[model samples]
Target: MAPEQGTGSRSGCGGKGRGRGKHLPGACWDTLWGDHSPPHFPSGQVVKLELLEQVQAQLRDVLDKAMEEAAQSYLQPHRKDPPTQHPSPPHSSGLLEVEHFRTFYHIFIAMLCVFILSTVAVDVINQGSLDLDFDLFIFAFGCLPTVLATWLVMFLYTLLVPYKALQLWAGSYHTVRFPRLFTAILLEALLACHAAVLGYYPIYTVIQHQLPAASRFIVILKQVSFLMKSHSFLLEAVPGIIHAKPPDGEMKLPALSTYLYFLFSPATDQLPSPRTPYVRWKYVAQNFAKFLGCLFYSYFILECLCIPVFTNMSKQPFSIKTLVLSIFNATLPGTFLLLLSFFAFLQCWLNAFAEMLRFADRTFYKDWWNSTSFATYYRTWNVVVHDWLCYYVYQDLFWLFRGRSRVAAMLSVFIMSAIVHEYVITLCFGFFYPVNCSPSLPSSEVSAGIQVCLYCQEWYAQIHCPLEQKTFWGLVTPRSWSCRS
Candidate 1:
C-alpha cells in the first residue's frame, strides 16, 4: 500500500521534509501533476463527470455484492443447513478418517482405558476391593421422565408453529393483498411468540421439576438447538419459496418428511441436496461405544480428581487460600472434563446420531484441536452449533449490512452463543449466574476485532477448510474455557 518512491519523494509538502528543512506545496503539486499551476476546466469536465463516474462505479460494485449476498442468503432454492465456511458444498469426512492422523483415534481409546484402570486402582487401594459407585452419576441423570416430557412439549411446539406459519405465509405471500406489510406483521408476531415461549419454557420446566444436571442439560440443549433450527428453516425456506418462478401458478411447500427429518437430524443446517442413505450399523455402534466411553472416562476423571481433594477439604476449614488452592487443583480436571464433553457430544454423539439416521452428514466438527487462531477455533469447534451461528446469525446479519462491518456480525454470533450458554447454566443449576457470559462476551468482541481480517470471503474455494499448520498455538486449548472455569 505504500506509494511509489518517486511519488513519496515529490509529495512531502510540509513545513519540514526528511532531510530538507522545508518544502513548498507548489513544488510537490507541479511534480505530481506535471504543471506549476494546472489549467482550470469547466465544472463538468473532471470534477463533475469523472467523479460522478467513479462514484457510480463504486456504488455499482457495492450493489452487485449486496445482490449476490442476498441471492445466497434468501434465494437459494435449497441449502437449508450446509456446513460452516463453505460457499459451495463442503468436502466433509469423519474425524478419524484423516490420512496421517489415525493415531489420534487410538490415543483417545487408550486414554479412556487409562482413566478406567486408574479409577479401579484408586478404589482397590482405598476399599481393598475394586468397587465403582455411581450415586453422583445417578443423581446427575435423574428425572429422565420429566426431561423427556419437557423435551417432547418443546419439540412439538417448534415442529409445528414455525414450519406451519412459514408454510402458510409463503404459499400466500405473493398473492397477498399487502405482501410486505402482512409479512412484517406476521414475522414480528411469530418471533415474539417464539421468544416468549422458547425463552421461558425451559427455565419454567427445570424449576418446576427440579431436574438433575444431565437431565437439565438435555432440556436446555434441546431448547437452544430447536430454536436455532427453527430459525434456520424459516430463514432459508421463506426467501427461496417466495422468490421461486415456477411455470405453474401454485407454489410448492417443503415436504413434511423432510422437515421432520431436519428436526431429528444431527446437523442443524440444511443442505442443498440430501445425502444418500448409508446403513453403517458398525459405525453407529462404535461411535455409541465411544460416547459411552467418554462418559465413563469423565466420571472416573472427576472421581480421581475430586475424591482425594474433597476428603482433604473435609478435614480443614474453608478460607480464601483454601478456595484459591482448590480452584488451582480443579484446573487440570476441569480441562479434562471440558475436552471429554467435546468428545462426547460433538464427536461421538452427533456422529452416532447422524449415522443412525442412515442419511446424514458426518461433519459435525473439524480439527478444532489444531486451530491456531481464535477465529479458526470459532469456525472449527463444534461445527454443528457453529454452522447454525455462521449461517443463520452471522452471515444473515453480515449480508444484511451488505458485507460491511463483519465485526458486528461476528460479535452477534458470540453474544447469541453466550446467551444460550448462560441460559443453560442458569436453568440447570437453578441459579442465574452470568459467569459463563461475563468474560466471554468481552473476549469474543476483542477476539473478533483482532481476527476480522484473518477470515477471507473466498475461504470455501479450498477443498478442505484447512488451517495454517501452527507449530505452537495449535496445541493450546481455547483460553475462553479457562476463563469460564
Candidate 2:
C-alpha cells in the first residue's frame, strides 16, 4: 500500500511539472484567446509587449516629474512652466488721461481764438491796413502785455494743471466724480473744430492756389528761414537784441546795463580816448580766414554760372546726370556760403566777447573748448543759446523733478533741449516730410529715427523706476517687427 501511494505522489508531481512547462511565462493572453487564435498567431508575444508598454509609461511619468522639478528650481517665481505676465499697476505720475489732455487742448484753443479774433477785428476795423506784431523784448509795451499775460497763464496751466488733474483722476479712495473731466473733453473738441474753421477760412484762398510741389518748397524755405532766424546763434545781434530789454521805470539798472545802454544809445558822449586796446593776432587771423572762405564761396558760385554744360542741362529733359549737376551746383556753393556767413556773422555780432572768440576759434584749436565746429561751437561761442536752453529746458526740469533724482532731471532737460533744438530747425527748414524739398526723395527714415530715439530717451528718463535697466533696454532697442516693417 506504501509503494502504491509513493508511485501516485511521484506521478502527480511529474504531471504538475509538465502542465507548468506547457504554460509560457507570457501566455496568459494566449490562454484567454486560444480558441480565437488563428494559424501563425503569436498571442503570447503580444501580451508580453502590452505588459512592457505599461511598465514604460509608468517609468516615463516618474522621469518627467523629476525633470520638471529641476527646471522649476532655476526659474523665477513668476516664470515657472507657462510663465506669468502679471500686469503692473499704472504709474501714479506717468500718464495723463484722455480727458486731461482734452481740457488743455480746449483752454489753449480758447486763448488762441481770442488772439485771432482780436487781431482780425483790429485789421478789419482799420480797413485791412491795420497790423499787429509781437516782440519778446518789449513785453511791457503795446497790446503785447495783455496778450502775453493771458497766454502765459494759458501756457503755465497747460503744463501744470493737466498734471494735477491727472493726479486727482488716478487717485484711489479720494476720487471725486469725473463728470467735469468728460465735460471738458467735449468742450475742447468743439473749440478745436471751431478754431480750425476760423483759421482755415482766412488762409484757404492762398493755400488752395498753391500746388503741392510749390507748397512743399514754400514750407522748406520757410523752415530754413525759421532755423536761421530762431535757432542759429552765430548771429549774436539777434540774441543780444533778444536779451537787451530797456529797464523798467521801477527797477534799478545794473552798472553793466547802464554802460551798455550808453554805448549802444544814439546819444553822443564827450570823447576821452583814454585807452586803446591791444590788437589780437588771433582775431586778425580769423577775419582773414573768413574773408578767404567768402572769396572761395563767391568764386565757386560764379564758376557754377561759368559751366555752360550744367546751365544747358538744366533746360533739357531730366536725367540722373542733369539732376546730379543741378543739385551739386545748388548745394555746394550754398553750403560754402552758409559756412562763410556763419563765420562772418560771428565776428560782426560777437564784438563783446572778441578775446574769448579769438581764443576759441584760433589760439585753442582743441575741439572741446573751440566754438567754430558744430553744435558745441554754438553753445561755447555764443553762450546766449546755451543760456536759453539752460533757462528753459534745464532749469524747468530741475524745478520739476530735481527732488526725485538729479541724474534723471539732467537727462530729461538735456533731451528736451535737444528735441526743441531739432524741432526749431525742422520748423525753420521744412526738411522732415517728403517733398518738403524733393518729390523724388524717399521719406527721411534717418531723420525720423533720430527724432524717435531722442524722444524715447527723454521719455525713458522721465518715467523709469529705480534700478529698472530692463525698462531702459525695452525703450531703446527696436523690436524685430519694428525693423522689418
Candidate 3:
C-alpha cells in the first residue's frame, strides 16, 4: 500500500517501481505526492508535503519488518499430524543463501554491468543521442484506459461477490428451513454467476478491445489469480460452516484482512515460514538488483543476438541446412530467455514481494535444470504452483474417490492446470493451439477426451469467431506471439 514499492497484482496501477511485475508492465505511474500525510492527525489541518515522503518511507519500513506471512502449509507430504475437521487452506525464499551460489550471482552481476557499459558506448557513438526509447514499453503496455477499466471490473467482482455470498450463506444456513436444499441452490447460483463474469467477461474484453501484449497478460493473469484466490477462500470456509454449527453470535467469518492479504500474496495458497523475522534491506536490494540483471540480460541478448540471427535468416534463401542452423542459432536465445524469465519473474521479483510482505518460504525454484526425467522436471520447475495444485486438486480428487484412483486424481490436476493455462493463452494470443498443453497421461482416454474437446474448440475459433478478424486455417496460419509465452 506504500508508494515506494508496487503492491501485488491486486492493484496494478499506481506502481512507482517502474520495472516491477512480470504481468503488470508498469502501465501507470503513481502520483508525485500521496493522498495522506503520515505525520498528520485526523484533524482538519493541511500539513506540508515535504516531510510526508520521508515519514511514509520510515513507516513502510517499520511495517515491512513487523508484518508476518500467513501460517498455513498447503503441501507437506510426509507430515504425520492428523487433518483438522475444519476445511482451511493447508499449505504452502530468497534468491540465494548458499555461499557458492551467491558468488556465482556476484560474478554474473559484474559481467552484466560490463554489457550495460558496452550498450551505453554503442548507443553514444551510433545514435549521437542518449535518449531512451520508452516507446516500445509504451506500445507493449498500450491501451492504458482499457487495462485499468478491465482490472477495476474484475477486482470489484472478486472482492464483493464471493466473500459476501459466503458470509451471507454462513449466517443464514442455520436459520433456513431446508438447509441442505438451500445450500445447494445458493452454491449452484454462485458458481453459475462466477462462470459467467470471471470466465467470459475477460474473454469478451480482450477480444473486443484487442488489448496490447502486456495489457492482455495483466488482464488474463489477474483474472486467473483472482479465481484461484476466491476459490481457496471459499473452499476453506464452506466446510467449516457446514460441519461446525455454533450459536448465532459465536459464528466466525474469515477476517477481511486475511482474505485481502491472501489475494495479494504471490502464491495461490497462504505462505508460512516462521524462522525469518524482519526482511533486511539488503535482501530486498538483492531481489531488485537481480531483477535488473535479468532485464539487462534479456535486452542485450535480444538486441545483440536473437534479432540479428532472425533477420539474417529471413533475408537468406530457405533450405534444410539453413533451417537447422537457424534453429541452432535460436537455441541460445531461447534457452537464455527461458532461464532468465524463470529468474527474473519467479525468483527475483516474486521473492522481492515475498520479502516485503514478510513471506519466508523462499523455495521459488529447485534443481530443475538437473532433473533426469520429465516427471521430475515438471514437479520441480515451479515448486510453488505445483505444490498448490497438488494440495488443492490432486489431494481432494484422490480423497474424493477414497484414494483408489490415483490416476484419476493426477489426470484431473493435469486437465485443470491445462484448462486455466490454455484459456489464458487462448485469449491473449487470439488463437488456439494446445496440442502440447494437454499431455498424455497413459490412461489415454482422459487425455484423448481433452484433446478432442480442444480440437473442436480450435476449429470453432478458426471458423465461427476469428479473434484477429482474419484467418487462413488450411492455407496459412495466423501468427501469435507473446512475451509471456
Candidate 4:
C-alpha cells in the first residue's frame, strides 16, 4: 500500500462502523484519519495510525463501561437533591415595644434587675472590698449621699408626682398645689437617712467581733425588737380611744385597763379587735386575747411555711443589719397596709371623734382639727408644731404689725413647714452627698450637712459604701425601717 493508505488502514477503528452518534463522511475521514491518524499537521507526514486507532478504540470502550456503571450506581429510583430545603423562617429576636414592655414586662424586668443587682451586691460585700473597718466608715458617710439621692429621686418619681396627679384626676379638690417640690424630695432623703441609725449597733458589733451567725434568732430579735418598746397596749389603745369617742353608742370605747394590760400580757386578749374597738374591759380583754391567739397562729403558720426554707438556705450573718433587713423584706408587702391603717382607720377615727365633739358643741371647723382646705389642713392636722409656727412665727409677724393676718399666718405656716421639713431632709441629704472637701470637714458637720443638702451624687460608687451595704443587708435581715414606714 501507499504510505498514506497504509497509515489510514492501520488507524481505522472498526472500519468507521455505524454507532449512536453522527456518521463520519468519507471526505472527513480521509482528512482527519486517512493520512493523519494521530491528528497530524496539514503538512504531509506519515504517523503511527494503527497504534493510535487501537488506543482510541480501547479508551472509548472503557469510558462507555465506566459511564454505564456510574449511572446504575447513582441514578436510583428514590434518589433526589436534598429537597432544596428552604431555610427555616428566621427566628424571632423577642424584641418588645415600649408600650408592650411597660404594660406586660416592666415589673418582671425590674424584679429580675433587683435580683441580679442583689446578687452582685452580695458578691462585692463577701469579696471584702476595702476591708471591714473601712467598710463601716463608707457605710456611715460615703454611702449615705448616694442612698439619699436615690431615695429622693424614687420618692419624687413614685410618690409626690403620682399622688398629685391622682388627686387632680380624681377632681375632689378644685386646684392643684405645687409648692415646695424641692422640699418634698428633701423630706424623702431625711427619711432614708434615719435608716443609718440602725447601723450603730451593727458597727459596734463588727468592732467588738460580735457579728453572730444569722441562724441565731436571739441576737436577731434583740436587734430587731429594739424599736418595740415595752408598752401598755391599753395605754396606746386608750389615747386613741379616749381621744376617739365612736359615732355610734353601740360602739362604746374599749376598756382602757384591759387594753393596757394586754399590751404586757402574753395572753391572746392583749390586742385590739377590728370588729369591736368599742367594747368594755371584759369583752375587750377576751377579744384581745383571741386576736393575739390568732396572730400567734398566723405567725406560726407563716413560719411553718417560710422560716424552715429561709433558715435552712440562708447564708447570711445574723447581725443587727441582717435582722433589720429581714424585717424590711417581711414588712415590705404590708407597707401600704400599715399606711392605710394609719390614715384610714387611725386618722379617720381620730378626726371623726374630733368632729363629733364639735357637733356636740354645735360648732363647725372651729374644733382644733377641722381645716377648710389643703393649706389649712397642714396647719391644723399637726397642731402642736403648728402652735409653734403660730406663736413663734405667724404671731410674731402679726405682732410686728399689730394684728392677725390670715395671709401672714398662711405664709408663715407654709414657709415654716417647708423650712423645717427642708432642714431635716437637707441635713440627711448633705450626709449622703458631701459638698466641701477639706481637712476642716468635721464628722458632725458632715452628718449635719447631709441632713440638710438633700441631694446625692449619681456616680458615687456603691461598692465600699454604707447605704449600699445596708440595702443588701436589709434583704437578709429581720426588720428594715424604710422611708414610708
lDDT of 4 by residue, 1-485 (tens): 22235554344424564211112334436654556544323322223344454565677678879988899988877634334332211221111223663453455445435544654576578885432232322333333343344334433333233233333332322123643454356346533542443324333433344332221222223322221212122123333422333344222333434433332222222232222112133423443443333333333323332343334323343346544444444342233222222233223332333232221111111222233445565443433345445544566577775675768766766665665453332233222222222222122323223322112111111111225345545433322123211
Extract clashing residue pairs from model 2. Answer: 223-428, 223-429, 224-428, 224-429
Candidate 1 regions off by >4 Å? 1-93, 98-108, 121-130, 244-248, 310-324, 432-485
For model 2, give the 10-residue run with minimal summed lDDT. 87-96
lDDT of 1 by residue, 200-242 (tens): 8777888788888789889888888888788888777876777
Off by over 4 Å in 4: 1-373, 404-406, 426-485
What lDDT tens digits, residue by residue, belong to model 2 across residues 1-485? Answer: 22124453243224322222222222432443465643343667556645654664567578878888888886846533432432222221111124774574466446445545665686788776655442311221234333334334333433343333333332311233664575467447534643443223213422443323223233333332222222222122223322433343222212333333322321122121122123344644655664554444434333333233333432344345544445544453344334334444443223223332221222111122233334454355434345545554566567787467767766675566556554433333222211222222111233223332223222223232223354656544422112211
- True-vs-predicted CA distance for residue 370, candidate 1, Å: 2.2
- Output the better candidate (2/4) by TM-score: 2
Error of 4 at 264 (Å): 19
Q: Which lDDT values do the candidates have, in the order given?
A: 0.65, 0.37, 0.65, 0.35
Residue 384 alpha-carbon offset, candidate 1, angstroms: 1.9
**What would the TM-scores of all predictions be?**
0.66, 0.26, 0.67, 0.21
- Error (Å) of candidate 2 at residue 441 is 22
Q: What is the C-alpha RMSD of each candidate to the true structure, in Å?
A: 18.0, 31.7, 24.2, 33.4
Structural RMSD, model 1: 18.0
Runs of candidate 3 with Cα error greater than 4 angstroms are: 1-92, 121-131, 248-250, 270-276, 279-282, 311-323, 433-485
